[model samples]
Target: MELDTPVLDDHMHLDPDHGRGIDAVEDFAHLGGTHLLVVNKPSWHLGVEAGDPDAVDPAAAGEEFREVFERTIKVVEAASDVLDGRAWPVLGVHPGLISRLVDERGFSPEDARDVMQAGIEVAAEYVADGEALALKSGRPHYEVSEAVWDASNEVMRRAFECGAEIGCAVQLHAEASEDMSEVAEWAEEAGLPAERVVKHYASGRLAGPIPSVMSEKERLRVAAESGEPFLMETDFVDDPDRPGAVLGPKTVPRRVRWLLEEGYEDAVRRAHVETPQSVYGIDTEATLSE
Candidate 1:
């Protein structure tokens, strides 16, 4: 499990109450993977019921999300003991929940946005308190009404603002697209550099935010060879029903080893060492040594 450079999965999830949880971290550790950014799951996944659309109290909305974010931080703290490097929490409301708030919960688009923005503000509090390393937010990747879309964008902008104020990164679960000029513009307006904004589950090098590319061999090679600032991830949801669905916990380390064997030494170093430190502002060497 020892590696010369730290292998960081920039975006991942562990559902201790429902899935493999820390055992998944053990799997990664056993394969030479070192670090993780454990993102919070959606509220429903963490056992938070959908809010009453009729009572969209902006003041109480964050309290509704508190348990979900706290649980994610608890898991990350526990996971630090299992990982060879470290596990940092990335807390926020998942963007996909917007649809549920609107359609299933009967929330109007604006109310749903207010609820989500409040959740992001709560998440920023955790980062500000030093319990988490980053914030997670993005517009829905699925179709929605134009009003819902506009509201979702506002929520994302709020995330950017929170991240800027807290002086941390924001990991985005956005649609798969190369042209992210609009998002780049938003980052600029929020005063958080595009380099600190990561596109989670990205397929290749992207325009705006730094990409956290899925750790498949070909895609990894493309991103590495492009010589851009990027990171790698499994995007492993750790769902027992869909075991090893997106990619297994062992995927990142194994792929990094494969690239090392392929003589991509510099590429491996860029991905595992340099880029992560530059983007997340964490000391990879210091973390792995610990």
Candidate 2:
């Protein structure tokens, strides 16, 4: 299906183990996707292989994230070469890593904050240098202790501050909750605009001033009721081991087609074209023209 307006996937992952690389990107484009916000997954220093997050050198962990951030820029460049500037990187430290540092890696809250701030600094450099478009941080609700949860929130607050300093939008990865007013409040306090904040992998039921990357499973009625300035995503993990883990790469394009068929062309245009442009500062026309 071809869309008159480009369809954007607000959040996705691409790595050797997760996103399956360029071929998967091609698949997404062939299915009518025009833009993507690709995120960098946490580093091995954060314990991707080990079930346990034993204590590691904080400097070593920071180095691991540096390497990953460099690789993430390369991935974005490669995807842009393939997709003709349709792909952009959203760089930051994952909040789950903060929990690991505090809970399993034996990091003092101060030390963990230092490491997280370091990661955010790297992300800010990328954004300031125009290599990345946005920053991301999240609180993983599951599999974290209460202390870790609270610590993650603090880390995320620092992330918001980083985004404010660097003038980059922040995409948050957290579960859908009835009350997200605190999120807006925090963003405001940090000097970040609520309109620039994104709730990644959000449900249609979510309501607030902050924008959301709605899943394909979102109800159309709920989407309509939620108001304007929303985006769509598949959150494709690209893990061969967990095929279709979150959703397929083609999910957003297909969803756009479905929405168009349902005669919601204006809504599709707003979500796919206008919202992304306003939120991420993407030039959709230039991206697709390339």
Candidate 3:
């Protein structure tokens, strides 16, 4: 599919495996994708289990985030080298990790909150310093205890507060069944604008206070009909063990091309150009034209 307008992938992860990481970005660009927001891979801090924050020392988690940030910077740099500065970074603490810290790392709710706050502060600093485009935080709805779920929300609340202070967007990774309206309300209470909050990996039917990144065709149609702005993403997790786990990096561009072909050109433009620019403060015209 040929796309006249450049595409933006709002959510993706770059694995530490350099070969696969480079290939992912290169393939995305080759498929007409111009801009990407590469989220820090979960394993960077969560380890092999991808949720076992207990495997690492609590003190080392801070260092782990630092390493992840530095490594993500390198990945974004390499992607920009290939895509001409179209790739950007989004850094934050995963909600699952917050629960693990409490369940496995012997952190009380208060202690976990402090650690979560500190991590979010660093993410906010990165945004303020122009190192990242946004901050990410969300709770997993499955395989987690109620206590952990509650604690995760508390931590995410703090993240929203930090985002409000630093003027950065917050990308959520919660489940489809979760109430997005509640999430948006909390973000508003934290002093962040509803439009600045993004629900990652969402479907068209789920509408809330903030916009969403939907990949399904039918969902895209539904979202477009609402007259609300949205974005597209593949949520590409570049893990060798689970190749194309969620979707391929080219999925968003392909979907956008399909939308264009279907005469939803205005919807495509609103999602890929206007919405992202408004949410992340990215100058799509300048970034893609470059």
- Strongest candidate by lDDT: 1
Q: Model 2 reaches what TM-score against the true structure?
A: 0.89
Per-model TM-score, in order, reads: 0.97, 0.89, 0.89
The number of clashing residue pairs in each candidate reads: 0, 1, 0
Compose the digit string of candidate 1's lDDT tens values, residues 5-41: 7889888999998899999999998988889999988
Q: Give the TM-score of candidate 1.
A: 0.97
Instruction: Judge candidate 1 against the unseen true structure and give its global Cα lDDT, from 0 to 1.
Output: 0.87
Total clashing pairs in model 1: 0
Stretches > 4 Å off in candidate 1 = none
Q: How accurate locally is residue 253 in candidate 2, as Cα lDDT from 0 to 100?
A: 83
Writing each residue's lDDT as its tens digit, candidate 3 over 85-141 gives 388999887766655666676776556655665676777778889988899887775
